[model samples]
Target: MNLKNLAAAALFAAGSALASLGVPHAAFAETTKLKVGYLPVGVYSYFWRAQDAGYFADENLEVELVPMAGGGQIIPALQSGALQFGISDALGVLNARKGGLPVTYVSFNFSQSSDNPVHAVLTTNPDIKSPKDLEGKAVATNLSYNTDWTMMREWLRKNDVDIDKVTFREIPFPDMLPALRNDTVAAVGAVEPFVTFGKEQGANVLGHYFTDVKSPVVLSGIVAMLPYVEENPDIVKGFVKAVNRAIEDFKADPAVARETIGAHTKIPATAIEAMNLGDWETEVPPSEMQFWVDAAEKEGILNETDDLNSLVWSPKE
Candidate 1:
């Protein structure tokens, strides 16, 4: 009884020690890593920095820095599961929901401040002064009458600037600066990172609206295909933790954040922080989303609708 029992106990102790060491044959598999997509813009500075700085490592995510050509592909890629998540504007998310797209917002990248100052108006025409002055002139925007166009139009109408009196042509953002210098577009909308770049080029920053409109009028956030979120809540959860770390890093050691951002985004950190850079956090204040939806409805860009439940997506607490 004594010899046999002692031998069994020793074997059991050895097995327990091996188990504690996490033997591959018996241990649970590592979590599946995530490949999130993002654009190289100041709006996503934290995300870019976080990817480079290994912020997602703790969350078990291996971030893939996707340099998006534009939002057009990002949305479709999300739909097709080509991307686990993406950083894109509120307008694009709204349009996707309105059109029955299957993607859902995981968290807001930026949505907190009155002086946030997005979409700065850089006019080439020295004669055209304020935002009000651009009414009669032709404006160039990457996506006309879609994004800042509604707000621009509203600001124009409120200030008695005739909407029909002006014309709009779609021009890529980078091209606008050269176009401005060459006397092509009288005025162009330049959001952060680009705004600073435009200013450096000697373009007159006539006006900026994000400084006033503290609403969700403009936003770029984390979005994942609904299926991905459903299939892997853990991945989404990790993304939040990673971004949260990055956000704190951005505010705390801005110098380090800039270095990280400059490297990943290919946009200078000085240029990035100097622009109309707004808040970058996890808050998705309902009031902000209302601003975009209400503004769109008021401008007739969207008919009367009520999908607040689905239109908005915030991180699950």
Candidate 2:
């Protein structure tokens, strides 16, 4: 071989060696890293699926899914810039907004519909058969100001039970069953997986909350601080795309969703099989979100009417 040809071959070999060693090509760029927080519940089906499926990598994004106490409980972290994104309920997002925090819900992962309700008021005391019996009793909810809590409070009021008479306790979802079993709380607001597990633990199923709401109620969603979202609109869009794809993929095969749930939640296979899965939707429909806003205003959770359009980050194609 000629000297020039040998030199070319040697250069090619060096380049291939570098590429094999994961040295980025001249045009390659680092993936954007973002910290996302979730409640670590089985209901966060799509979030776990997206991570396991490499959807985030597909968008040149690296997501760090941090397990938080609860979605609503992580608002302060999100506001402090400690977290780039958080999964929260409509009530939490609105309450945060009303409290003067600039936050917005970006996408809906779970919603309460006629066919599928995400939360329920469960009681070990069969004597407290209905909401009317909740008066003077201690009821526990993971977040005092979240979607399920608001709906349960509203249900109590609408059922002729005075809200002030009921004692509201803040307890984590996992501890709710023990709280009820040990009589720490007379009734506990439980969501999927827990509700099924509570039943297994001999807790009486009172009723599913939001059963009578005429419109679909958003249960939980991806929330981000306004500044973070505004500064990274393209990143936010990519996130939504990955989440939406995950939702569709899960819908196409529900067993896969359940498996993802079990993997993240560590819930037993039997409980996961029996638990009712959430109605997962990616699009943020303004009309559906209005249900929570209206309820919040009427319940005095939000002092003023909220601008629905401003509170959601709907990405345009």
RMSD of each: 5.5, 5.4
Per-residue CA lDDT of model 2 for 52-145, tens digit only, reads: 9989888888999888876556899898888888888788878888788988887866766767766778898978888888888898888776
State each candidate's clash count: 2, 0
Q: What is candidate 2's CA lDDT for residue 204? A: 85
Superposition TM-score, candidate 1 onto the true structure: 0.83
Q: Which candidate tops lDDT?
A: 2
Deviation from native of the Cα of residue 168 in model 1, angstroms: 1.8
Screening candidate 1 with a backbone cut-off below 3 angstroms (N, C-alpha, C), the clashing residue pairs are 117-210, 117-211
Q: Whole-model lDDT for model 2 versus the true structure? A: 0.80
Clashing pairs in 2: none
Write candidate 1's Cα lDDT for 10-108 as tens digits.
877777787778743223335555666766766677776666667776665777767786556788888887788887666777677677787667776
Error of 1 at 286 (Å): 3.4
Candidate 1: worst-modelled 10 consecutive residues by lDDT: 23-32
Query: Which lDDT values do the candidates have, in the order given?
Result: 0.69, 0.80
